[model samples]
Target: MKASAAMRTALQRQWQEGGWLSWLLFPFSLLAAAAVAAKRLAYRAGWRRAERVGVPVVVVGNLYVGGTGKTPFIVAAAHALRERGHRPGIVSRGYGAAIGPVPRVGCGTLDPAVFGDEPALIARQAGVPVAVHPRRAEAARTLLHQHPDVDVILSDDGLQHLALARDVEIVVQDERGIGNGLLLPAGPLREPASRLRGVDAVVTNRSGGRDGTLPTPPAGVRAVDMDLVIDSVWRLADGERRPLPALPAARRIAAVAGIGNPARFFATLRRAGIRLDATVGLPDHYDYAHSPFAAIEADLILVTDKDAVKCPAPDDPRVWAVSVSAHLSDPTFFDWLETRLHGRTPA
Candidate 1:
């Protein structure tokens, strides 16, 4: 069963207080924990060998199940590496998309129904080679063979992808951090907090705080601050460029978000002084085939960039996509990344 807002909030509070509810669900949590442990053990015991290709593989992912800015970070990382003269390709499981063979990305040819929203967004935003497969290793191999000039591979949300060997692992955490610090069905974490001990770096979208803040990184694990900043706003489908509307003028906007945290999107709009006359929060990567807001009237329709990828221009002229970029404040993270890339065997 899907969790309610009240249940989610209670779970978070229970985690903070170490309440009895956590204990009541401890039995199931234990099973989930055991499964994660066993999976890791299998990889460690050499029973499941991780495939390592010649090119460097950098994975940006989070321990939590919900969104933590992984897609934006991957887009930013691809841009960063490209600026430094590195050809980077992306691989994703294409979550929420129908399973299929390795798929290619191209203008008007990339199908969101087959490759998922984030992968399609990355392809459109980065304009770089992208391949999607349930098995990321397979996709990476295909990407490398198709575009042999690529020097590195950036895997979007692949912390748990044991089959694909990686040279650098960057763990991403948002304001929620590891919500309630509990496993699935009870909390938000996909794995235990201790699993973060081995990653190359830890990056937090928010700057600081305790609750709703990322934890301090362990020694040898670098910590960095990352922020998602909007660049510009554009009319939906028409692709007509326009300045972000002033708060007073945008007070009656209708906001729509098909992401892990729709509330976060709404809060951002509210902070921008946009009066949300209505807000529709659909499941993550929701397709726009049948929208609930067809009957609702509004002056403007605001959406995230990820959602815009599935809904191309002119089809929804009133829609505007809010583009965000991930900014890293720490230099050490880049220094380490450069070192790793330089050390890789020449491709």
Candidate 2:
């Protein structure tokens, strides 16, 4: 069932409060959890073989079913890998896109609607080869075949897809850490919190917070803190770029975030010292074909880079996109990630 605005807000509250509604749905969570465990066990017991696509695969995913800065993290990680002498290509499920048998995504190829917003945005921002298919393994293979020099495969949100064997797994979490701690239809988690213990690394995207430290992870698991640096805002009309401070103080603003955690986006704007008259949290990967901006009272509209890609050039010049980049606190995570991707320990 599509979550209503009230339901989405209630779920967000439940993540923090663990209210009665979450308790009421707990029975179903158990059934969902058991099924999830059995599927993983099948892969572990060799009942299902994980397909390896010749190159090392690094998966960036989240245990919770929402945005956890995976898009920005992958863009940052991909460039960092490139700097360390590895070519990275991306593979995604291309949710909400109509990717046919030919699933390759690049310049002069599929439109955002046809290729999916995330895949299209990744290709545009990362400037690397990307492919989208419901079957990620097929996407990865097609991506590799097209970009043969690609040394590493970065799987976007493929932790549950055990069909694709991965050498390194990095699970990212945002401010809404394991809300309600229950399985889908009840709470936010796709896997149990204990799943953190098995992954190679856990990254906390504390971009919304002011403090230096990330929220603590489970016991025995080392956590890396990441910040999303809001670099600039670009005019959606003429592609005119301006520093964040360039936002006109005269106009009232509305921060519109269609991401998994819209509050985080609003917090980002607040941290940037831009006070919003209104904050709108649309569903994740919201199609902006019919924008809600018309009803918004604010004179200016600000959106995330992800939303910016899907939103067509607004007729109004007041609309702008805030572009952000991920900054990981621990340099060692990359070194560790590099070693795992190469399957070699540094001398």
Candidate 3:
């Protein structure tokens, strides 16, 4: 395994199943917790002002530091709003990009390498305006400047970014919930589990409920369930819609996922009855600058949509991107959100 991947595995083990390493790192987490608390306090006490971008901002964020179906959820929510006659724009912190203070803003097919994978995916899939920068508030302003009709903004995973003032906060949690429920460096939680109590809505991704029910959420918080179903597979070379069952039942099939939780992608394909000969799970937000596909030998290759954005082998006919969409248990979640959002004065 690569050194970084090995370290990530080790840390995941430590975070999920506490050990001596997690305990050894607990002190550092305490310091991080202190800093996070102080920073949030500064915002709350008016020491640091949060800038609102003259629109109703709904932050689809995370408490856990990994995948929770936030990207697909944001795309799905954007579609839902557009269907309801509300124009929505998106803003992100461009997690894996090398951008500066100035925000990169645009619509249509954007370069994931320049704008970040998730934002690019949102732009392409939602066909809505998207802007990305380290400062999400700045990105929001830029997006609004270009798309002045945007009535709402769906922020991609900025729960801790207090500077980007939001009207509604929605936390997306996967089956892992909060690993070990400790702060950064010691556990997977970016914020305390108590953070859920204050959010406007909680989205549980694939809660694994047999009867299509989710666990009880924190008191008074509206909750919904999200499951990403493999919608279809498209050719990276020609953007052909190759259905899963139709993809030649012959040949060695290998799936590659460069996502926060790759196992989920592999399992989704498996459940879709795709007989794969191999699965390559890369690190979250993995840059394809060094294409793994060059070395992966397979007659057919499948990749997650998030990874597809930054894939270097778009011309390789052997590779295809799996298109997945979020299936919400309660469709009314958007209606509930829209009502609240419309209650506020949108920019």
Candidate 4:
């Protein structure tokens, strides 16, 4: 009825076959390709300016849209910088915000509606200064002025924000990698794979057969592996935390996710052995104003940390949010990052 659940699989096969599907979409892809090329050309030719702040800026972003673990990577990077004694602050474009002009985020000071969900999540998790502006350069400047002591600026999801010059660029990729390797509408790539040639590093979030290995990089581009760690679960209403209960061990549960990868969330819940009464996958960054709460009459409502931010105070005491961390396995990854941030090995 809904086309087919194998839509993505079919698209990938079609893409690999290089047939009419690819040709039919060639014009659209070409247009997207041209726009991306022009944007990069403007930056290269100095027609577009890239603003550099006083401190080093590290950008954590993805080529594909939706959750590729960029936010978690940002948190890990900020923590890493802090451990090395480099005071780190974050800046974002504040996607989905209704208000703008360089908004500042601090403890208990930002509204998700104005600063967007990810910035608020970063501010809350990093416990460091965060700022948002449509113009990332302005956001970086505002953050630096507000917290002059911050020694490093981390730009969340700014791989394509060429206007904000960055010292380090970390492109995060999920299991989908570039996703059929086509540009928007036709597939999921926001920029061509060639664009990754210039980045400082590549971090893959999850490891699956597809999109598992890092793409061929340009000379000097480093590839690394990163994993997501679900530390524990928390009550969504008031942030009361708990360990993820042993899975397949629980019954009468409902899993909710308003993130880029809803299926992943659902799969995680299923793996935990919890018999899901229902799975509610809201659009990414959903405000939760019209979430199907009526359908969630289960004993427990499990959600991701990102979704918990927007959900109303849980009407039922059983609603919980799972908070996750990104862990990089390569020792060299941190070593390289430390060198970039501090110009020396961390003590």
Candidate 5:
């Protein structure tokens, strides 16, 4: 991992538990919490009006700051909505990218660096048009203008972005389930645990382990589990689909992930019975401007679908990308979600 990634990983470790470092940072978290509360109050009091893009918006986001598998859930939701006869388009803030206010539409052929890693992954996997901008509401407007057939918009990571008015709000959580329950600089949350109470639904993701049970939801909060099952594996050098077991019985096999939760990818591979020689976790949205595993002696380097977009095609053939599909614990979850879109059903 790069130096910046290492430092971030270290901080995330501190966020999972209370320590002197977290306590020292607790005062700063209060300042952030106060700012968030104030902004929310402004919106709630009508001091600031949220803009709508003339389409029903469904925002899928997390309170854990990052991870929690929001991108996979977005892709899954888009596919499910299409099957239910609703045309869906996706909008994102294009975080970690230098894109300006102007919206950038995305496709599988788009450059991940120019757009965003998550957007690129959604475009490639979900087969939906994606519009990215700093302001998600603007992206939604641009997406609707470009794809007039779309009657519903999915906002990737827009729970905190109150500028975009959403008809349905869904918060995705992982096994950690609000560690230490503190706000930023102290814990992982962008919003407090109370935020989940207002969301249309809460989704607990089994991103790290397949058989692993989901984190228990807070009392009175209804939550559902989401399983991300590995659907297939694709070779990076060439877009060839191969089963996990088919990956050459090489002498040394390793995995490297730059997503929010690298351990999830590692476990998915292990569950598939792939023996890994080593595992490397980098910061989320790790740009593959240069291959970090270039010098590794492994015969194959396993990567996740999100990280694969950055390495759509790598010079080295050892790199491979694993694809996963989000499966809700209960099929009825889609029934509930579809009900939310009923009023905005496409004419």
Candidate 6:
């Protein structure tokens, strides 16, 4: 379910400052936590069988509901795995797609509306085979069957989806951490904070702020820091590239983001030294087929790469897409990931 602005604001407040709303919703959160715990227990107890794919699987996910930079990390990890001599494939839930059993995603393969924007973006950026289905395990199998050369599979945002067994589990966290460290309805987390204890690695994603702390992981779990790097901005109309800071400062820039966390997008622009005269925040995975740009008043428009996929080539030339890359502060995490995947240290 998409979050409304009121719901978003209330949840954000709960994350920053706990109030009566969280306490009022605390009972429902308990129900959510109980259900989540029960499902996990069923999988662990083998009450429900977790199927394993032919190839190793790595899951990059977050406990909270909003954007924790999973898509960028998946794209970066897929490329990194390829560089290490392993063919990688990605699978996603296709949150906004209207698909059947399984649809393979690639550049020009399927419309973003049919395969979801994030999946389309990953396929385009990573140049790897991607498959989307509500059942992510089935999607992984479809990707592997279609691209037999893929030695590893990366499941994007499937931490709570226990049906898909994983060899490596990476939990991503924003600077907000767990957001009151409570479950759904009361807070932002889908699962409990204890879930981090079992993840293979915990990545703290920082977009703007300096505070990089998160709940400590279990003894053996590795924690890493990541920053979203906006390398360049490209105009969607003609694919013209310009350095982010090099954009003409005279024009009024209006940033539009339909992502999980619109604030992060805005913060990225501000950090890049662009003053936003106006900002439009839409629900995560918002369909831009309606085109919000018609009403926005500004000299130029800036959008996230996620939003760029769904937007039609604008009749207006002022529209530009921000291209971001995931930069891990700790390069050792990649080495550790590679070693875990292959069961041997990289030479």
The stretch of ten residues in a row with the least summed lDDT in candidate 4 is: 207-216
lDDT of 2 by residue, 1-347 (tens): 23577778877788656888888888999999999999999998999999999999998999879898999999988888998998989999998887788766564334678788888888888878888998888888888888899999999999988899998888999867776677876788898888888887888888877443334676655578888988999988888998998876646888888888888899888887888888888999999877777787877899998888878656878789999998889877777788776678632
Q: Rank the candidates by lDDT, best first.
A: 3, 6, 2, 5, 1, 4
lDDT of 5 by residue, 1-347 (tens): 46876787678778876788899999999998999999999999999999977878998989997788898899889988899898989998887788985899866666777788888878888899999998888888888888899999999998999999998888888877787789998888898888887887888887675444334565654478888887878888878998766767688999998878888778878877888998888877778776777677899888888888776455688888888888887777776777767754321
- The prediction achieving the highest lDDT against the true structure is 3
Please, what is the whole-model Cα lDDT of each candidate in the order they appear? 0.76, 0.84, 0.85, 0.76, 0.83, 0.84
Model 5 steric clash total: 0
Q: Which ten residues in a row have the lowest lDDT in candidate 2?
A: 210-219
lDDT of 4 by residue, 156-225 (tens): 9878888898888889887667656777646678888887887878887762223343456667778877
Model 2 pairs whose backbones collide:
none
Question: Residue pairs in steric clash, candidate 1?
Answer: 236-319, 237-313, 237-314, 238-314, 251-275
What TM-score do all the candidates reach, one by one? 0.88, 0.94, 0.94, 0.88, 0.93, 0.94
Q: How many residue pairs clash in each candidate at the backbone level? A: 5, 0, 1, 4, 0, 0
**Residues 1-347 of candidate 1: C-alpha lDDT, one tens digit per residue:** 12554555565567555567777877788799999999999999999999998899998899877676788888888887887888989988888787666455442236788778888888888878888887889888888888899999999888998899999899988777776778865666788999889888888875222246556788878788786766667766667765565322543578887887676777766665567888776677778776545554876788898888776445656678887677788745565686777875321
Off by over 4 Å in 1: 1-24, 102-109, 207-211, 245-251, 312-316, 344-347
Where does candidate 3 clash, by residue pair? 54-347
By the lDDT metric, which is better: model 1 or model 2? 2
Model 1 TM-score on a 0 to 1 scale: 0.88
Model 4 TM-score is 0.88
Which model, 4 or 6, shows the larger lDDT?
6
Candidate 6: tens digits of C-alpha lDDT, residues 1-347: 23567777676888656789888999999999889989988988889987899889999999979788899889889888888888988888888878886555554345788788889889889988888887888888778777788899999898989899899999988888887887888888899888888888888778856564566678878887888989999888888899987775656779899998888889888887789999888889988767888787888999999999888755778889999999998877777898998877433
